[model samples]
Target chain A: MLDHNAAAARIFTAALIVIGDEILSGRTHDKNIAQVATWLQVQGIRLKEVRVVADEEPAIVEAVNTLRARNDYLFTTGGIGPTHDDITVDAIAAALGVGVEVHPAARAILEDYYATRGGLTEARLRMARVPAGADLIPNRFTGAPGIRWGNIYIMAGVPSITAGMLEALTGTLEGGAPLLSETIGCWVGESEVADLLRQTEKTHEGCQIGSYPFWREGRTGANFVIRSVDPDRLAACCAALAAGLTAGGRTPVAGGL
Target chain B: MLDHNAAAARIFTAALIVIGDEILSGRTHDKNIAQVATWLQVQGIRLKEVRVVADEEPAIVEAVNTLRARNDYLFTTGGIGPTHDDITVDAIAAALGVGVEVHPAARAILEDYYATRGGLTEARLRMARVPAGADLIPNRFTGAPGIRWGNIYIMAGVPSITAGMLEALTGTLEGGAPLLSETIGCWVGESEVADLLRQTEKTHEGCQIGSYPFWREGRTGANFVIRSVDPDRLAACCAALAAGLTAGGRTPVAGGL
Candidate 1:
């Protein structure tokens, strides 16, 4: 496991390669992008880009190669299954310039899975093949473990399993302090948050303050949101926002949040 | 608007450029990617890529340039609202190498909207500024219309409205026959699908047949999905799958699909 606490200050970037035809066909809603984006952000890593490609080998290989080369980390979800459409291994193998081999670690895991689950056949063993010189990101959900090698993390496309595997692998990553955010809702519209939003940013340098206009109960209002990695600075900004809101006569409660 | 029929036969490609901090923060689940993917798929246009980016101008600018340059069509959603986080217009301007101007046609629509909504301030008018030389994609939800310039089609991130706008814009683009697909479920495990899946693909030279392993109701099975632009070819693959399943002692239903 990597020391996540020590790597806080450095920049981390990731790219998601969503490989599937169902997603492109609009039959399947990708439940991964936003989830991955947020997880990376809170971990102090930036999800720099995402690419959704069809199951085509060339497209997948090209995407994996391009993104893996450019970003600090590449987390790919989808295309790791037992079916014939499951070609992420081939694509990744191509991307890394390596041959696909049944990884011993993954093979042991699959054997255990077959012992427990029963009826898992050699076709299921296809999931055991990992590119040369790769380790596994333990799949807590099923037998098919994901691979992590050279900044590329290949996981499953299934939403529940993808999230769980990512969470399990969280400790392996070096992360900065999780970003903290606070929000204050007001009857004020964007126009009202405009001045405060600008002032808030100026007063709290290094923090991001944004005005969000929303409609609720037939009334137009705005939510002022503040985000920063610095905890003390975050609290100070909240205090200033509460004071400003109260001074502006908006009955600021505990949440200038 | 461009002629829809003219755009139908051409193989149009799209890239989704999502701009929002909420998405990156996981504060919100982005509903735009799947919607656009489905819309483009049904239109005979392929949604080739998707990128969910922060509201940062540079990120949006970079994604716009990349997606637009590579694909035949590019669709962007979010960040074109009436608040501080809404920086899509300026980014699109930067992407297109043009100045940000209040598109007269779009501004007229906004004026009419404010006349009724009663909270239309100058800040609200910010939604009216589009990249110079862009045309508007009509908004069915709110009056703030999405815009189109060059190869990019920009729309709101909100699902209902984004979908409505996409539906309205469908007739304008040229594309191939929407990729047709046939899906059949079986109780046989994914291993069973492997041989049949390969055979189906081998038989249908131009079609893509994907076998997906799914576990549900204490039974592990695979869904045979055959996709192609030609309807006859897709049907033939499905027929072969059914025949193969029946030969293997599993009575496959011809069509519950």
Candidate 2:
């Protein structure tokens, strides 16, 4: 396990690789992007970028290598299951230049799990396979555990199973202070306050302000999300931004419209 | 407009670039990925890849250049709004090596739109700005239209507005035959039928079969999706797949389980 307190000074960032032909084909709407991103944020690690690629081997290998090399951590969801098409393990193993073998602990777990349900057939045993030197991320929902190999975590495509893996991973990986954000909504065009947002962000170091405009109920409004590592600084920035909106004759709504 | 029928012999592919810091921060759940991918499929274009980047100019520019250079078409959603943070236009212009200009027709639309609501203020007029030599994709919901420059499309981040822009673009871009797919579900583990899928796909040229496994009600099941450009071939392939699954002692469910 990484030291959370020792890594407090450095900001940890992660990249997510969504691997599935179903997603690219639009047959499946991905819930993992939001789920993983939200989970990583609470772990105090920023999800910097996400790439959705087809289940092809070359695409998966390229994405895993590129993303895992660049970010502090890389998470992959999908293509790890009891199927020939589920080849994320093989692809990632190839990318890492390691041969895949069935982990004994995982095999035992799956054996015990399927003992009463059904005998462990060859197909069911495929779930025990993992890349060399990989550890397991426990999945309470299913017997097939997630793979964690040197900052690269491979999770299941199923939303429920992925949730279980994430639940077991809580407080295991090291991370810095979680980012805090406050949203101020105003019934005004975001362009109208472009300078104010930029100036406010400039005035506060280590803060980013994002303006999201919307047209709803025959009216235009924008939600300004102010984010910072420090909660006090985030609150102060939100207050300043709200003051700026009020000075411009627009009432700022707490939360968002 | 590109002639869709003329490009029937070639395969057209597209890449999507999702721009927003809110998405990375987990503040916003992206609805555009599936929407754009589905729309592209209807246009006979395969959505090959998607990259989610922050609201930064260089990141947007890099993604635009990389994806546009590789794919037949590139679609970008978000960051093109009446706000200072909306720098997609500037980034795309920089990538295309063109100057940013106030499109006269776009300006006219915004002027007429704001005439009854509020006079076109400086901030509102910002919507008229686009990369030089870009055409507009009309927005029925909002006056600020989407942009089309060469093979790149700049669309609104908001899902509704993006839908409007995609609606306007229907049948305009040239593409090959739209890919057709059929789903067959079986109450058996995917690995049990891995060789069946592989052999089925191998027998049917131009067809790809993807296996997605699920665990429900204490039983395992899998959905096999077969995709092909030829409808007759796709139907034939599905028949073979269903026959194979039945041979393996699994009842095939139509339209998936």
Candidate 3:
């Protein structure tokens, strides 16, 4: 089990499994990881790792097993379609030792969804496939629903569907309070004040310190982003950092992260 | 062993390690994974996984070991600066069971890099420190340089630097032919043709099919992208797919993946 004793700062690690042959072939530029990573951070969750794998059964099964065993929450996007390549549902079902078929509730959603246009046929009815003992996640856009099995929440490959499901699912699930970040960006080359920067980092015990160097117009400088669960602590660390850099002769302006 | 010997098709996997705390704080949106994935893919290399970790020794060391063991190649970004968070060199050395300090060639790169800038202090000279027995990767942007350790290539976290390092390293590595992809954007919803799509997938053994449903301007449709290492096979699969969808009364458009 992961260490969850500390309420002060418990890192919420997430593993993003981007399942699609399109991504592997460079057909689809994955927008899920970046957007999800940003969202997780806002929710005080740390996105530890991300995986992009082909729409193959063995590959998906192996990736899910590996990532699920390691992280706290596993959010998977893609392969939950009605087409031939949409095998994520089956793979996930097999991985959990569950049977996959059309669940009544999920079928109800698809049946209602298809009735308006074309009555549910074999091609369209495939959207109702759900693993045993799983709950259906309503799709506000289309009638075909998604399922939530164990800790794995499967969403549509399209960004809209994925985001819609996450909005609902994320609300129902518990999450740590959001993390706040502070950054100081100014013109001080890393090489010019390497000694003082090292000292400031040593002084700050728990806060995370990162130096980002940028070249704009010709001047070079590093941006120090200090992040912590506590906003007060972050501000305090930044103050000390600015004072430290100033006392060492360089003028630093701060804001970011 | 990863058991790649008898694979029916050429499959390659990679993991990205971002050794900086700025990412966790949302200060810098990482672009390395997307760019590198695109590059590796052009040469038929698959990027499987990625990890954005802090500069903490234990975290970096643990991540390097786990990722390297799972994938064929591991590309690391950030944490090779002249500052204190620049402990990637030492942490990697510790993970590899080797002692680390300033290797001569790495030190030379730093010396030359500093000579153009003006002077190299002991602090600035810290950028030269690299793990022992690492082959140096030439840095076209700045001279502090990156190193290649076994299958793992340690690179700059900065977007431009990492990209430059990747280009120089690409020609030096052995890779397979490029992967080809094809996409068919259909004006029909996924739920309308999911079942037939599954059957089409079951029939085609040589190609991978992915259907992505998108909503634009009150119209909802699915974009199906098929992928494979073989170009002729991919074209053949898409051809059959067009016929199958047409038979189902849904018109599928043809395009690039």
Candidate maximizing TM-score: 2
Ranking the candidates on TM-score from highest down gives 2, 1, 3
Residues B224-251, candidate 3: write the lDDT tens digits: 7776777778878888889988888878
Over A193-223, each residue of candidate 3 has an lDDT whose tens digit, in order, gives: 7777677767776676767887677777778
Better of 2 and 3 by lDDT: 2
Give the Å shift of residue A159 in candidate 1: 1.8
Query: What is candidate 2's local distance difference test score?
Result: 0.89
Model 2 CA deviation exceeding 4 Å by range: A1-8, B1-9, B217-219
Would you list the rank order by lDDT, best first? 2, 1, 3
Worst lDDT window (10 residues) for model 1 chain B? B1-10
Give residue B18's error in model 3 in angstroms: 3.8
Candidate 3, after superposition: displacement of residue A231 in Å? Answer: 2.7
Ten contiguous residues minimizing lDDT sum, candidate 3 chain B:
B1-10
- The residue-by-residue lDDT of candidate 1 on B1-257, one tens digit each, is 25654554456677788778777677778778878887787777888777777788888888889789988898888878776667899998997889999888888888887786665577778888989998989987678898999888989876777887898798788777687887887777667567777777887876887766666777776667778877788888888888888888876654322
Winning candidate number (lDDT):
2
- Model 3 misplaced stretches (Cα beyond 4 Å): A1-12, B1-13, B24-26, B54-59, B66-72, B193-205, B243-252
Highest DockQ: which candidate?
2
